[model samples]
Target: MTYWSGFCSLQKEVQPIELTKRQEMILQIVKDEGPITGEQIAEKLNLTRATLRPDLAILTMSGFLDARPRVGYFYAGKSGNQLLGEHVRKLSVKDYKSVPVVVKEETSVYDAICTMFLEDVGTLFVVKEGGILIGVVSRKDLLKSSMGNQDLQTIPVGVIMTRMPNIVRCTLEDSLSEAAAKLIRYQVDALPVVKEAENGGGLEVVGRITKTTITRAFVELGEEATV
Candidate 1:
């Protein structure tokens, strides 16, 4: 819950940094005369280095310029779209993951379906004791099981779930771009975000990354860009 809150807060914080006129001038000067020192830039603008510090800082922080220790500042040469792509690629699965909807292996298919509907999630991570992930159950899995003659209340989800080694999953360190790619390549609606358990047990289910999750991210990015 705390993590999801933090993620929402982060999305709200991505306001567009509007460049000042002098900041625009600084960029043009760097573009025309790059590999140029900060002192040189100030000299060209007929301003003191101290007076231009904040503008330089803003440009650098906003990805409009890159600064070197001795070599000085240069144009980053990234368009707004490119910068947006770079930002999206840098998003970590851990940062954006939503709390996973989970079920135990022994959980009945009926109960699993109920949980899925109540939680409003398309996929459920099947975990053993200690939250160790064992398998994944999707909407299709439940639908298929429900169509069978077998009793839904009696059959355990473990019987129908796509078990580990067959499950396509992601780790905390994984980039969101990788998670999105896996979703496309596997044609799965969601991927469990997992991590190695401290007790050397197995991959522990931490959170979830879904098609909706990725879509939300893009939507948030669009909102930020337009802000």
Candidate 2:
């Protein structure tokens, strides 16, 4: 039987639901031990019946917990045939394309632009003299540098690149959510995916993480994790 029948019968009208921490805690409690009552939950959590009422109401409304007049509350398994675990597993980053394009630090801005256009990407990784990532150059950066007196054909990317100490990077194993959060937090469109060098003094650009890459990965693989 549906767990929400009790609350539904009482309300008869639809209402909005907002789950708070306390409500979430209560839901966990019911999932762990129900056919249980709000009073039982309150007693276990050391909260009064009055204080637990709102939490119970919210949990019931949100479809996480269902209430019954006398049978108490119970954990409702996934609605219909949907499996929550399988749904989450399908959203993993392990199912997508993640290769990043890169370039050497000494390469000319002209070369970087050419690579960007040829690869149909917006950012290029700038590696050190040893093929370690030291910077990144975006299409806009090259365009800005080329708009004036700078000679794009002769100018090295390092001159206009977002260099070390300022470049934000992500590890190859970071979660897509975490990478996306960092990009949003830093206001950057791309991140260099790097690995620590064996000597422990530098990082090698193994790949690149960009918004477009993330989006495409999500669309193509049905996953959101991309770093």
TM-score versus the correct structure, for each prediction: 0.70, 0.56
For model 2, how many clashes?
0
**Model 2: per-residue Cα lDDT over 1-227, one tens digit each:** 46688778767665555567787788787766665777889998899999988777767767777654544676666442233233323333333326777887778888889999999888888876556877888888988988977778798988888888788888756666667777899988888777888888799766767788667744643332221
lDDT against the true structure, each candidate: 0.88, 0.72
RMSD of model 1 against the true structure: 16.6
For candidate 1, the TM-score is 0.70
Model 1 lDDT-worst window of ten: 78-87
What global local distance difference test value does model 2 have? 0.72
lDDT of 1 at 187: 98
Model 2 earns a TM-score of 0.56
lDDT of 1 at 117: 98
- Over 62-104, each residue of candidate 1 has an lDDT whose tens digit, in order, gives 9989865534677798455554555667678988999998999
The lowest-lDDT stretch of 10 consecutive residues in candidate 2 is 80-89
